[model samples]
Each structure stands twice: as C-alpha cells, then as structure tokens.
Target chain A: MDLRVRELIKKIRTDKNITFLLALVAVGVFVAQIVYYVQKGEVFSLKRGFQALFLSVTLFLLFAVLQRITKTGKPFDKTIVTLLRVMAVVVIVGGVLPSCVEVFVVVIRGGIYTIDIANLDIFVPVLGVMIGIFSEIFSYGNDLQEDNDMIA
Target chain B: MAIIVRLDRMMADRKISLNELAERVGMSNVNLSNLKTGKMKGIRFETLDSICDVLDCQPGDILEHQ
Candidate 1:
C-alpha cells in the first residue's frame, strides 16, 4: 500500500476511535440521567424514559458500528450496512413511539386527545429513512469492492 | 467459469518459480498465486500484459476456454 493511503487509513481509524469514545460517553450520560430520575422518586414520564432508553441504545449501536468499521478498515462492509439499517429502524421507532405513548396516556386519563399537527416532528423518521437509503448505497459499494478484490 | 487460467501450466513450461514470476510481473506473491490457481475472477489488461512479458508467451498461452 502507498504511504499516503496508509496514513489516511490511520487517520480515519483515529477519528473513528474518538467518535466511538464520544458516543460511549453520551450513552453513559443518558444512563446516568435515568438513574438520577429513578433515585429521586420522580414520576418520570414513561414516554420520556423510553425516549432516553432508545437514544442511549442508538448511541451504543453507533459506538459498536464505529468499532467494527475501525477493526475491518472498510467502511462499506456488509456488517456495517446491516448495522446502519438496524439503526435506521431503531431511530424511526424511537421517533414515533413517544407520540403513540402520549396519545395512549391521554386516552387512558379520559382526556380528549387532539392531533397537534404543528408539534408533530417528522424530521427524525425522515432522517432514519435517509440512513436506510445510505445503507443500501453502501451495500452496492461493498459488492463493487468485492468484485474489485477478486480481480488481479 | 468457461474461461480458465492456464498460468500454472505456462509457469511450469517456462520453468519459472511463482516468487520469481511475481517479482518480474510487479505483483504480490499471493495475487500471483491466486492467478496461478485459477482463484481470480478476472485479470486486468495491464497485469496480463506484464505476465505475458515476463513469461515470454501470448495471452492464449496462459488462458484457455473449455
């Protein structure tokens, strides 16, 4: 391999390690928030708790995906594609489930539930779908890389 | 796999070691070994040219269709 390419790969590995560490720290912070809420005997909204849990899980998955990419030294790996797809699904679910839970809670409390169109946040699920699309693109790139490797 | 690599036969006929051919062809031993064993999916024109130059043979002498 050329020295430049080796240097670039090393730089990318270092960047990924930093990102992974940051993600781990973010997960720890979220978990600590949940613990603090539990210890305070606060009536933590179930929706809020679930959102925190989902966010933490997503961050941890990001950490794992970054670690895997660093280890393989290939961003277009099949496993990374799969992990990104899973992350996309999780993000969509995380975005939508809180709203569903809010509606359920309102209905159970005997309050007339109204659709707040202005408050509906569509960006999160859209971001998830975009990630899914990117994963598909990465899958195609992985196939091309495999083909290139097979040739002399 | 209708097209087959006959690199092993060519190398044997020329009495060339894999390491020597790889060095002369400017390719790694593992890649040259893969070519010799017919494990490669395809060959680049440049690589084929180099191998031919090293072996003093034509492309047909290193490849065959069955």
Candidate 2:
C-alpha cells in the first residue's frame, strides 16, 4: 500500500474500536437478558429473535473493534482515557441507535397517522437522557484522571 | 515512554541521596518521587530554583532536552 493508505489504515486501526465494541456488548447483554427473561428462556419468537440478532451482531462487531483498539497501544493515553471514550460512545449509541431505529420502524409501519410528529414531545426526553449520560460519563473521566494522578 | 530522569544520575554524581535532596529542596517525598520517576509533566521555576540551590548546579545539569 501507499504511504498515505498505510497511514489511513493505521488511524483506522487506532480508533477506539474497543469502546465501540464494548458499548455494543453492554447494550447487547442488557437486551439479551431482558429478552431471555421475557421469552421464558427461549429466543424463538420473531420479535425476540429479531432483538437477539440485532443486539448480538451490533455488540459483537462494535466490542470487537474496540478491543482491537485497546490492544494496539499506539494511542499512548492512560487506560482511563481509553475506557472513558469507550464508555461514552457505548452509552450514547447504546441508548440512541436502538431507540431511533425502533421509532423509525414503528412510525414507518404505522404510517403517518394523526400523531402530530411536529408537536411531539419526544426530542426533549431523548436529549435529556443523552445529556444526563454525557455528563455522568464526563465526570467519570475526570474521576478516572484524578485516580490516575493519585496512582502516579 | 523513553523519559530520561537525569535527577537520579545528577544526584549520584553529587553524592546526594533522594531524601537529602528532597529535604534540601523543601519538597514532599511523594512529589520528589514523582520527579525522580519522570512522572512529573513539569517543574515550577520555584521548584527548579530550590533544587538548583540544593544541588549547587545550574538547571542545565538537571534538565536536558532530548
């Protein structure tokens, strides 16, 4: 490969893929537990199967990528930094992607009913959840940094 | 990761122990440990001054640009 191509590949590899993957895994395991319990320990029904497959693939792919990033050691930051980045992405994507997808699927299936999408109160709650998670994760990073400083 | 902690070497050449230097510089043992281990991102001018005074050497002896 050319030098630029190699550099690009290196960057791609260094991206905090572990965080992504772990986040995926967190969401996956959470959903899996719910589904398993809901379905009486059987992952059979179409809805349960769909949930399982979606969560499993998403978690596995994302977590695997993140795990690779953590293993590279080229990023050269504290483990805390790496973990925080991973946690934030995991938390955000964990909460948003599935909900958004589900909402889109439901809306599309239901057709544009009399539900006034314009006057909807949906965005505020979602934004609040995102912000809450973001703040918690941001503080978590700071705490981790302080812990590292103490350790050092 | 290849940080060179010249503090130990300089102290050794001057026949100084870490405790003696830390006491002379009026720094806590913990902070001194951090400096000696190259865990310090920076040293204040006051700290450098104190260290230089105690070591009887210029800042150049303690810090070398890599």
**Candidate 1 lDDT by residue in tens digits, A1-152:** 56665676777677767766766665666567667656763333555666766776677677777777657767778898888899999989988987787677777767777898998899989988998998899999999989998999
TM-score of each: 0.84, 0.37
Query: DockQ for each of the predicted structures, in order?
Result: 0.93, 0.07
Q: What ranges in model 2 sit over 4 Å off?
A: A1-114, A125-152, B1-5, B26-31, B37-41
**Model 2: lDDT of residue A11:** 65
In candidate 2, position A45 carries an lDDT of 35
lDDT of 2 by residue, A32-122 (tens): 6566646663323323444444445445544554454345432223443444445445444544454454455556666443545686545
Native contact fraction per model: 0.94, 0.00
Docking class of 1: high
Weakest ten-residue segment in model 1 chain B by summed lDDT = B31-40
* TM-score of model number 2, chain B: 0.87
Q: Which regions of candidate 1 are displaced past 4 Å?
A: A2-5, A32-48, A109-113
User: How much does each candidate deviate from the true structure in C-alpha RMSD?
Assistant: 2.7, 13.4
